[model samples]
Target: MKKEFAVIGLGRFGGSICRALAEEGMEVMAIDVDEDRVNEFSMIASHAVVGDTTDESVIKSLGIRNFDHVIVAIGDNIQASILTTLILKELGVNKITVKAQNDYHEKVLRKIGADHVVHPERDMGRRIAHNISSNNVLDYLELSDEHSIVEIVANEKLSGHTLIDLDIRAKYGINIVAIKRRNDIIVSPLAHEEIQTNDILIVIGADVDIVRFEKKVMG
Candidate 1:
């Protein structure tokens, strides 16, 4: 079955989610308090309406609880965001994801039963900083506060070494999950698979272990 999504807030983040969901052929309802913003998404979303989501009657009228997932993306106004999420939870929405302004906002949202909370700006900043700090780190994804998946470029130091020879999992407590060579990708690469210079290694491990592996092996 196609999952239905409702996005409350028509700012950049919410609008982007609407567009991506629409592109993926999902049914999406876009809502905003501003008529202009709602009108802008009229052709992009399955339905676009101008309404104050914080008002219980407004949300009930739209049948928002029917959506499989709801995203509270209200910008700047932390109070409104919390209120909207609370309303969604009260209405028995199955899953709710909220964009949090900061740590405090996130804590409040969690307490109010938000299924997921995201700090987009802060996360993007971290990704950019990681890329800037390391030449070998092609990309970084935070799986959690202490765990991450990183794409590291294999340098001369790591070339010709097999997984067994390096003892990656045993030594650094990290796993080389995949190897990307040219246009091809090898998932769950075997222990005997040899590393080639410039090969992109997709690794997963705790942050400390990943950092140690990068410095001792890739660096």
Candidate 2:
């Protein structure tokens, strides 16, 4: 069954998520305090309403707790975000994801029962910086402070070697989870699979080990 989602705040982050969810055929309700913002998404969302989420009665009237998930993407207004999240939790929402403006806001959101908190701008900046800093690193996803999954382009130094020949897990403490070659993706590639130039290696491991592998093996 398709999960139902409610996105409060019709800003960039919330609007993007609402559009994507609708595109995937999921039922999505878009809400915002501004009439214009709600009108803008009227055609895009399954239901678009203008309402102040911070008001408990307004939230209750929308039957928000019935949705599988709720996303609080209120921008700039930290107080409104916190109040809405608290009300959602009090009303027994299954899951709540919130966008935090800063570290303090994230801490508060977690304390108040947010299922997930994201720092989109900060995370995107880090990904862009990682891609720019190393020619080998095509993309990066932070799993935690100490660990990450990175997409690395196989250079000449690594192109001719097989997984077993490289002994990468033993040497670098990282696993090549998948190999993207041309248009194909090999998930959990075999030990005998040989890497080729330009093949994208989706590697997961500790941050330090990944950096070491990038400098030594990818060179």
Can you write out model 2's per-residue Cα lDDT over 1-219, one digit (the tens) per residue?
A: 999999999899999999999999999999999999999999999999999999999999999999999999999999999999999999999999999999999999999999999998999998899899998898999987799999999998887899999999999899999999999999999999999999999999999999999998877
Question: What are the runs in model 2 whose C-alpha is more than 4 Å off?
Answer: none
Report the C-alpha lDDT of model 1 over 74-166, residue by residue, as the tens digit.
Answer: 999999999999999999999999999999999999999999999999999999998999999999999989999999999999999999999
Displacement of residue 196 (Cα, Å) in model 2 is: 1.3
Candidate 1 residue 10 Cα shift, in angstroms, is 1.0
| List of clashing residue pairs for candidate 1 | none
Candidate 1 runs further than 4 Å off: none
Candidate 2 local Cα displacement, residue 95, angstroms: 1.1
